[model samples]
Target: MDATGDVILVQGGGSVAATRQTSRTMKRTANLQERLQEKSHAVGERADAVVAPLHGGAGGESELADKAGKSQMLEDASGNNVSLMRTMLRAMLHETSTQLMDEQKKMLERLWDALMGNQRMTTQMMGEQLEMVRQLQQEVQAVKTQAVEESRKVDELRRLHEQSTRQLRVMQEQTSEQIRTTREQTTEQLKIIREQTAQNFEQMRLQVMKEVGIV
Candidate 1:
């Protein structure tokens, strides 16, 4: 139970104990009062019976009157004392009850205020946790989006690399074909120049022989 409930439960136990104590006190007092009254009546009866024969009825008259008056006074005093005791008990009970009630009220108020304060704190903590969850979710979403963008860039880069590779292969094959054709042309030009030089040398030698024979 909460503090208020626990206090109320404890108070209930106290009230029960107080009630039992008061009941026992009242019962004991009532029994004592009955015994006292019975004893007083028995004493008065025995005294009258025993003393009546000891004197003539004329002398006993004043004494009997005195005894009766004393008994009556004792009964009155006892009654007054009983009344006073009852009044005192009632006052004590009332005061105790009032004090208990006041204390209980104060305790309940304090417990209620504490409960409310704890509730507010719990609510604030829950709100903070919810906000944290929202922020974490946003961060997770941002990370997912960034990862997707990076993946897309990697795919684009792969496509570009494949295209560049194909273009480089085609250029290399074209350059190799050009180099082979230039090599064949250069060999054919060298062969034709060598044949022309040989014919020119043979003609110069015959013209020199004719000049020599004429001289």
Candidate 2:
């Protein structure tokens, strides 16, 4: 087919492959985001539990009250620290996930570009190959035509040769017959002349004998 059509097919196949890869990357990214969100939620819940006020120890119990007071102060300090840590952890997870997704995006883009380049190269190679095949086919066709024409010419020459050969044979037979007829005619004329000469000599001898003889 045409180069444009082949290029379209290559591009179509490349796009499909790239799309599948992109979809997988997107799925992985979504999964990672979901997991990080769950982790952050868990951390938030734990921090809230730490910061929540403790129950019990209501009035008239000075020992219990003093113990509760000290425990409360320590817990408040620890809870604040845990909360701060949780916030930092959340920020870090968000930033890390964002960076990871951005990197994945860049990688997919590069892959897509690479695939397109390869497809274009493939299309060009295929076009060249097809063109070569077409040229070869045309050459083969021309060769076949030339061979046929040559064969026809050869056949015509053979026919003419055979005809000429037959005509020569006929002429030879006619010349040989004419020579035989002429030879026979010349032989018959010579035999007739010899017979007439012999008769004439016999008459002359008879006349001379008659004239010399006495009665």
Candidate 3:
């Protein structure tokens, strides 16, 4: 009876130790499960930071392409304006040259007309001077002919005066000869009458003395 009692007590103590060891093992397993859940949440936050930068870079590249297209269009418009200005300048130069040529031709025509008018005036003046000289020569010749006719009439009048003086001297000599012949005939008749008268006176004295006796 004493050994049997000792074996029963020993078996009961062994059973109690076994139950305490099982309870310690269950507590260690619950702590390990909580640490694994915290590690998973950290990995999800890192992935979100990487994806945001890639999305922003794609939008920036599209904006740069639009600005380059606008710059090319402005350069083409400026080149067309320069070409139009050059064409207008060339046309103005051609019109100015044409006007200058017309003015030069008109000046030459005026000079030619002036020369022809001067030549006609010189010819008319020469003809008038020649006619005046011819008239003066004709007047001088008529005056010389009148002077010669007056000289011939003076010589004929001198010859008629000399013939009249010779006729007057011959008439005076004939009258003197006729007066001497008449005086000689009258003296002979007076001498015969004186002798007859003396004889008659003597006869008359003798007769008267006989009658009266006193004679």
True-structure lDDT of candidate 3: 0.46
Which is the better candidate, 1 or 2, if ranked by lDDT? 1
Best by TM-score: 1
Query: Order the candidates by lDDT, highest first — what do you get?
Result: 1, 2, 3
Q: Which residue ranges in model 2 land beyond 4 Å of their true spot?
A: 1-70, 179-215
lDDT of each: 0.72, 0.68, 0.46
lDDT of 2 by residue, 14-96 (tens): 56544554455456556656765666666556544644443333444654665566567657655765675667557655654
Clashes per candidate, residues 3 or more apart or on different chains: 0, 0, 0
Error of 1 at 51 (Å): 19
Top-scoring candidate (lDDT): 1
TM-score of model 1 (CA atoms):
0.54
TM-score of 3: 0.25
- Stretches off by above 4 angstroms in model 1 are 1-59, 174-215
Q: How accurate is candidate 2 locally (lDDT)?
A: 0.68
lDDT of 3 at 210: 68
Question: Would you list the clashing residue pairs of candidate 3?
Answer: none
- Name the weakest run of 10 consecutive residues (lDDT summed) in model 2: 1-10
Total backbone clashes of model 2? 0
